[model samples]
Target: MLWTLRSPSVRHLQPCLARKLSFTPNSRLPRITKDAVREIPPSTSFREQVARSAAPKSFTSEIKTPPVRNQVIVFLVGSFAVYSIAAEQCNVETAKWTKKLSGSSLIWKVREPTSEELRKAKRLELGRKLQAGLSSLKDMTEGWSQTMRGLAVWSYIQVFQPILDAGDGKRTCWAIGGVNTLVWAAWQVPKFQPFMMKHFAHNPLSGISYTLLTSMFSHRSFLHLLFNCMALASFGKSSGVAASVHLMKEQAKNPHGIQETDVTWHFLAFYMSAGLFSGMTSHVMTSKVLYPRMIARLTSKAKPVDAAAVAKTSETITETSEKTILPSLGASGAIYAAVTLTALAFPHTEIALMIPPSFPIPIQWGVGGIVALDVIGALRGWRFFDHWAHLGGAAFGAWYYNYGPHMWNSVRATHLEASQKVQRPEKTD
Candidate 1:
């Protein structure tokens, strides 16, 4: 009985022993099977992971919307401050002139000039200017070679002659156009493109402050410069004066209200203010609204499973924001302000288009059409021009047209009072 039981147990044990003997040491040592061992993936750097993971969905989730500051408020406040300071300086100069003209130490009170006297003086000054301009033209042409003379004459006729013929306000606009031409010329050079785009163009993404001002005088194309200069020349007359559009017709009706002073300071202040306001508007819209939408679109289009696709999507986002969105440079915004102001100031005035050489259309109609077009463009997401900026400028111009003259008068009055106080003689016992 013991032999039989032992034999059965040994038979079972022999099978188990055979199986164990069949397995080699290599097979027993963690069996290096594909599923048994964890294969090491190729080493990738952290930056590469981040760069490759820029799928719109992941990127949007990772990046919170950037905080934008209230640059518009700052620009508005600074504009007023600059205007006040300029008015004060002008009053100070006027006070000095008044004192000089008094010709008596006992005369402490400032004498306000009659409108008739001012008109006579302006006429006399105009005569003197014409005489001087003629003399200079004769002298300039006398010593030039034939080719040089022809070039100079052509330049003067096409450029300098109009500037010379323009009034104080229009002349100032021409000077500004000269600056724009210089910037445009700089844009023509191959090497300067990068520098020009970086410094002269207003890139909302760059977070630069000075570019707001610099970009107002920047134009990349000749047609752009020509159009802007033409508009500026047409509309950029001093308030209460005649221009391409009959601005401030109500003021024109009241001859006494049309006190002509040098409007250089005022025009400069308005132009800069409009440009800054418009730039800030564009910046805010781009940062707050357009950028997120862009990211969303990009994300929707990207394939998350493909690493290469993700990387390409990221590169496209960078290029769109940096190259396409950022480089807004022109005087269009400021010129829009001038245009709207002219339209509102002279509602019945007519203007002719240069491109098509169309017959003169009502100024109000032209402004309305352009503004409406801009509104539609903004709504439809047109990328050719900064429509928001144009709208902002238009709004500013409208606001200024209503309140600007009163504000200017208030500034002048305040400065004039302060000046009178300074010039007043102290009573002696």
Candidate 2:
């Protein structure tokens, strides 16, 4: 009895046969010659056929791709609006605190505190808070093992103490770094891996908005967290009001103004904006451009088996799996923004590479080199890092370095005026 390709007896062999016959599901079926039909052994059992055709399952199939939507404009507009509102609130609160501490409403109108005065006040307040925290920790750890106590103290000094001592910019960086560390720790649990990947990692195909922000604080590896945190700290410190004045020696030209009362909100706003922009950039490039190109190549006509062909095919599949299917997570994009901004703001500053232990090089050169590498990686389709995101962040940093200060000043002035109006007594008729 002859066995047709679609016969029940050979139904299990269709995929294998189709692959062997060089025909895809959507392609026209080629005529099977007598010789080709006889190549299948008549005695081959259905079980054996099924076994031969089966390949190892991949995690790709388990991940569901959500419907694509263009969210670039919406995300940018919404995020910036939120940032503006938060900045206004922070400015008002800072004004209130200044009034309370000085015991004089005249300070706001007569003479605002200088940056030096603000810095001293900030440091004193932080010192008191740090002392209180340390005392509490000492009491709590008194009963613990000596080793544990020593470790706890060491960790506190190494982490929290420095964060408190540093300027508000660096303090904010450490706070973000702390969150990243927690996320990294969570990823180490075997059972938590799946959940973390789904929630913490940003998948372009996932069509989720929250992950774009969440992934900024999600570092999968200790080294990644360490490097990014280190970079953030360096840039944050360099960009601080005090540090910039010291480095530039031109406080008169500083666009951030002399009122260094509280820039925590401003820095936080910039960081979040950079992260969202970078994440969106990666998402659009993958979902709108690279992803479609990948699918087309994957479904196109089969090529002959050769070394180059096999290698290219493997690379394509791997890229698709890593970028499109598997999610991307880390703080590199936001850090890149900081790095570029610092480089441009303080062009005379020197920086040394942490990984290679390079001698101090001008920051401009260092940032330029880093950005060039990213450009090359993006153009060459390097799969190790999300180069598009890095580039996006760098672009935002440069752009903001020029215009962000003016925009922030405008927002603060508007809010301050409104706040004063509210506080003013209404005229009696």
lDDT of each: 0.71, 0.74
**Model 2 per-residue lDDT tens digits across residues 218-287:** 9988888898888887777634422222322333345556354656677777788888888888887777
Q: Which residue pairs of candidate 2 clash?
A: none
**Regions of model 1 farther than 4 Å from truth:** 1-58, 64-67, 96-111, 114-123, 126-165, 238-260, 301-312, 420-429
Q: Give Cα distance to truth, residue 268, candidate 2, Å.
A: 0.7
- Tell me each candidate's TM-score: 0.71, 0.70
Candidate 1 per-residue lDDT, tens place, 184-225, comes to 999999999999988998777776767777888999989888
Model 2 clashes, total count? 0
Q: What is the lDDT of residue 227 in candidate 1?
A: 88
Off-target runs (Cα >4 Å) in candidate 2 are 1-70, 104-110, 131-161, 238-258, 300-325
Query: For candidate 1, what's the RMSD?
Result: 11.8
Model 2, TM vs. native = 0.70
